[model samples]
Target: MLRYAATRILFLALGLLVASALIFATLRILPGDVAQMIAGTEGTPAQVERIRSDLGLDRPVAAQYLEWIGGVLTGDLGTSMLTRASVAGELAAKAQVTIPLGALSLVIALAFALPLGVVSAVRHRTRTGTAIGVVSQLLAAVPVVWAGLMFVVLFAVLLGWLPAQGFPRAGWQDPVGAIRALILPAVTIGIVEGAML
Candidate 1:
């Protein structure tokens, strides 16, 4: 089990590395001046050039990648290119909402999925298995937006059981309201994702 866990951790790291490289490559290869985009309309050519130099966009792709990897390792995401705000702080704030929602969604998904998957695999030749498979496929094909909309309509508009949107702006202060607002959307995402599993 230790070996298995280690293997999974290694694979996860490898996947993240590959994904980061792809993102960096895509940003570089995409048409248009990234420095200019970052500088926006207020910047002169000189300002843009300075931005590029500061960002090390002037560096070779491999060098830039290494710098990025180093920063990531050190938890230094740097500042926002546009606003010059702390990127790490912004991400940390956002994670409060995203992390809880994700956790709830994962729980909801697994609640449905584990049993459905077990039953489906166990009874593959049976009519019940066919029905479950068909339902899973149908749900998987349903776009997330459509699912979210349908959920909002049902629970928020019709039955009035949950909030449709406007999650508590109080941030973590109103934990109850925050969790309540997220339930419907999380469930929607959960069902859709669980269908794939």
Candidate 2:
């Protein structure tokens, strides 16, 4: 089992590396200059050139990719062009909100979906089971952004039941207040997970 798990891990890592490389190549293949795009149209030629040089965009594609992968290995994702802030830092901050919301939503999804799916499978011909299957399929078809915005409108805007956004830190007087902020986003993600399950 241990060896099997290790082999699976290695294969998954390899697949991810391959997928990343393919995506990088695809982006390069697309029209438009990436450096120029980063520099923006308002930037002068000198500014764009400087930005390209700063990003090592003058290097060959393979060299650039190698440098990028090396930097990623060293936990350097480069800076955000607009904010001039470390992308890794921004990601870490976002992850604080996103990770917990994802975990909670996944728990909610499993809590509902597993038993529901089992019931649907067992009582395949029953009206209630068919309804569950239909609802799941319909939910699976709904766009995530649409569902998120709808929840925001319903819970935060119209009903005034939950706060719309931003999380309270664990050190706050009401540490659990973050979940109130998280409710809509959690349900939005949970709906998709439940449908897929």
Query: Each candidate's lDDT (Cα)?
Result: 0.90, 0.84
lDDT of 1 at 50: 94
Q: Which predicted model would earn the best lDDT? A: 1
lDDT for each residue of candidate 1 in 13-128, tens digit (9 for 90 to 100): 99999999999899889999878988888989999999899877888999888987899899898777667789999999999889989999999899989999999999998999
Off by over 4 Å in 1: 1-19, 116-130
TM-scores of the candidates are 0.76, 0.75
What TM-score would candidate 2 get against the native?
Answer: 0.75
> Which clashing pairs does model 2 show?
none
| Steric clashes per prediction | 0, 0
**Whole-model lDDT, model 2:** 0.84
**What local lDDT does model 1 show for residue 79?**
74
Clashes of 2: 0
User: Model 1's lDDT to the true fold?
Assistant: 0.90
